[model samples]
Target: MNLAILDGGTHYHREAIYGDRYRSRFDRAIYAPDLVLADLEDVGLLIVPDRIDPVLLRRHRALLDDFLRRGRTLVVLGGNEAETWVPGVDWAFRPLNYWWWLDKDAVPVQQLVTPEHELFRHLPFADTIWHFHGILLPPTGAKALITVPGDPGNGDLGGALIYEDCVTTPGRLIISTLDPFYHHGSHFMPAATRFLDGFLNWARHIS
Candidate 1:
């Protein structure tokens, strides 16, 4: 499967994303323009990070929408440099890095929800991923994944949603607004192993 991480041209370098075993799992991980033209017909998922601009997004909206329309999945990450994605669908990483700790640490337990859901079935991820920087979860229908004091940058419960059993398309589609690639490959709790077990289990077979 061609898993593309939309980089929307931020200062965040392309090489920095290396070092994850998951890297090999992806037949190819690329950025915009190139990603836009790749045939999504055979692709399984698109994991975007702050990528979506009028030019690119407008050009590829049909491509992206068609992918989702066909039941494919899309994940978006948000932070300071996020401004390109379609607004209502986008969430912001609040003030603090809830998952990443600068001083203290938080415990991680499997607060699993929707186990029957295909994505979470037999997966290995705490109910809450170590929130380093997540979208400023909007104030509406987005589901609640993690509750807090709460952290300003809370990951939206709903934005992580995948419509698998809905219309003519029985496929799955998800849009996330946080960077869950285990940045720096630190393999720390709520960081590395914390999320890998779950996501990788049912991961689309990448060539």
Candidate 2:
């Protein structure tokens, strides 16, 4: 399958990850006014990584909607207001706790709700344990692949960290609040590297 990445051109993390390391695996579709459907015509999978400008994505929302309607896959990473551009996706921001692991009795917030899913075959749940920037309140019929348990006291009905939505459009949508690319590309977070090793491999072979 032909894969492509939306390069926002404003982040070094994107350059290190998509441009340098996985250059041969994906074609770059620079984020600009010229990025039209023609640029994604032959692409089977389009990756919108973390840190992409939400305003730019909003400007091309129609193009993205059209891409999905054409039976193409779309994968979105974390750190943006996806609700602004992506149809049926509602995101809620949460405070970051980089030191969550510091607590000796800390429980991992990330949970693999679908342990039998094929994605786990490539990426073990442990590799997905890093902190998330927010949570996704996915639309009805979307599978919550990974979830964070709700906190009843705070009235926070915790939501999905990773979800797969096949009901939103003709094609598939795999989205996550986990920003592995940003962490891995920055030369930190070993788990992020592990996530990419498996995620990219799984992405390459998915139909």
Candidate 3:
């Protein structure tokens, strides 16, 4: 499959992650403004990283829909603007809990909903447990791979952490609220690097 990524050019982390580390694996890095239909014509899998401007995506919404109609795959990671660009997504921002792991009895907030899914073969459930920026109330017919349980005290009315949607469009959509690349590129979170190591490998070979 021809794998590509949409680089927004606003953040250095994106270049650090995709340009330096995984440059050889990807076929193209189309700038967000230049995201025309022809740019995605030969792409089999497109990775839309976090921190990309939602306005650009909204401007090219039709182009994206057309790309999906051709049976391509789209992988969206992090950011709270999914509901503005992605079809059938209901995203809700929640307060971040960066220090949750500092507690002695703290367990991972994320739950593996589909433990048997092929993604787990590459990325273990433990690798996906970093703090999330928001939650996704998955649309009908979507398969939620990981979820966070509701904790009213924390104002975390829990929802899907990651999900796959095949019914909404002809192509497949893999969406996650985890900003692994940003954290990984920043060199602060080892788990984010672990996530990218497994997730990029899985994206390359996914059938």
Candidate 4:
């Protein structure tokens, strides 16, 4: 696949976790502020990682929408506050459950809302189970892939860890709170690396 990754350009966490991997794996790595529509030419997949410059993204929003209209794929990672830039994603913060796994009876799981989804064919659900930044209510007509398990009728924002909105645009839009890029780059979460390896494999196989 002719993949392109939008670099956020921060020198701390983003650089540590994504710099090397993006440099090695993607076809093009464009800095967010420097990104222009021309950079997306021939790109089959575009990845907008977390912590990107919102102003720059907004400035290029029209171009991104146009790119999607061409039936390309857009993968968004880590945007709890970027709903204004993204077409149909809305975010909500949840109390971080940092110690959920520490409980003896705790079952820290990310329910696969779409077990039959193609992404899962490449990645196991177990690899996606990890702490998230927050939950979000996906745009209308979006298919939720993973979600926080909660009472069915409760108004809890268990949050969707992974979701996609294909109806909002001509192309597929996958958004996630799963910050695999950061986790993998920091060498903190092994599962994140495994998840990303599978994700990249899936993206490459798209014809």
Candidate 5:
């Protein structure tokens, strides 16, 4: 698939987990304190996980933009509070209720906004309901795949948990606040494992 994942020194356990789960088709590159542009060659998709060095990413923003200008894909799986590295995204931090599933008769508020999108071909709704880091306000003409349910009284309580921005740049960008890789590596969330498996397959086919 020629996928490359940028490691921020937090995905160490992913090696062992992937070895046991399924063979990953993606390569990993250290997010060296100083980002290197050459590491991205021949990669169709670039994955940026959580805890990425925003400063380093910002320093090399032009390179990323140029990469996108060639119609490559970028998958960003984190929330950035200080700055926008993914371009055309406005982030809002939400207090996550991790234990919400433990409660009796609990129902997830996150809903699939674009149920017919091809991105959901491999990924089911159940695999995406675990937890998310925050919400995203994507740019115009973007497709929001998942969002919290809106409340009539509260006036649009739902915000985008996952979305794709094809208009913001020359390439396609799938941005989410869900830390799927971290949870999958730790083996703490079964849904994350399912998510990663399906996501990789989907990306492979898409690319």
Candidate 6:
């Protein structure tokens, strides 16, 4: 599938993570800082890194709204410490270097949170674990298939549906504050690869 990785404005670690996790699965996964809102085509899926600039956010918002209307999947990873053109998304994740999650017990990666959703196919639940800080949305029409319980430091809480079969007429919106792919790509490739397999499959299946 054709996918695009929009790095609104990123740091070093973010690049490393995207490279390790999503390097090959996509027919093409590019990292561009100058990408405009109107530059998007039928990219099937879009991964927006936390590098989004606030100044440009206003301009890109309309284009992104349009993209979601077309049934495209927009995945936002939480590794960044910047603003996103995509608004209203609340990301849940912990820093890889944070002391709160230093121990494995602090944040155990969940295999199955919402199995009923189509995003959980061929997933090696038992063998995989992920490190996420804060990646979550308001749960509007977007259905959250799975979620990691929240702790004082990290993890995501359950919310309303974020995806829609017929979003805004001809276009459908698939928004996810979950950045498992980003986390995996940055630190654990095996987990990231496993998650991407499911993530990509889910993106393609949505309207």
Local distance difference test values of all predictions, in order: 0.46, 0.83, 0.83, 0.77, 0.74, 0.50
Score residue 201 of candidate 2 by CA lDDT: 74
- Candidate 1 residue 204 C-alpha distance from true site, Å: 2.6
Candidate 5's error at 178, in angstroms? Answer: 0.3
- Candidate 3 on 1-207: residue-level lDDT in tens? 688888877555465446567777677888888878788877999988877788888888888878888899989988738888888889877789988988999988788989999999999888898788889989899999999788789776678999999999999999998988777767777888788888988988863
- TM-score: which is higher, 1 or 2? 2
Error of 4 at 32 (Å): 1.5
lDDT digits (tens) for residues 1-207 of candidate 2: 578777767565555555666666665555654588789888889888887778888999999999899989999999767888888999887888998988999999788889988888898889999778989998999999999877889998899999999998998999999888788777788888889878887887774
Q: Write the per-residue lDDT of candidate 1 for residues 1-207, one digit (tens) a residue.
A: 555455444433242244444455455556676665445656777665433354766566656666766666665443423334333344434455553445556553224344555566634445335554434333344443433333237643422322122233334434444444434233334453445445544555331
What is the TM-score of candidate 5? 0.87
Superior by lDDT: candidate 2 or candidate 5: 2
| Model 3 poorest 10 in a row by lDDT | 10-19
| C-alpha TM-scores of all predictions | 0.58, 0.92, 0.92, 0.86, 0.87, 0.59
- Model 4 Cα shift for residue 84 (angstroms): 1.4
Model 2: residue 207 alpha-carbon error in angstroms: 5.2
What alpha-carbon RMSD in Å does predicted model 4 have with respect to the real structure?
Answer: 2.5
Error of 6 at 136 (Å): 2.5
Clashes in model 2: which pairs? none
Error of 2 at 202 (Å): 0.6
Candidates 3 and 5, the one with greater lDDT: 3
lDDT of 1 at 174: 42
The residue-by-residue lDDT of candidate 4 on 1-207, one tens digit each, is 488887776653355435565455677777777878789888999888766667778888898888889999998887425687777778877667765766889887678879999888888888887778887787778899998765558776466888988898889998887777776766777787888878877766672
Q: Say what the RMSD of model 2 is.
A: 1.8
The C-alpha RMSD of each candidate to the native structure, in angstroms, is 6.0, 1.8, 2.3, 2.5, 2.4, 5.6
User: lDDT of candidate 3?
Assistant: 0.83
Q: Give Cα distance to truth, residue 60, candidate 6, Å.
A: 1.8
Q: Between candidates 4 and 5, which one is better according to TM-score?
A: 5
Candidate 6: how large is its RMSD? 5.6
The runs of at least 3 residues in candidate 3 whose Cα sits more than 4 Å from the true structure, single-residue gaps closed, are 17-19, 151-157
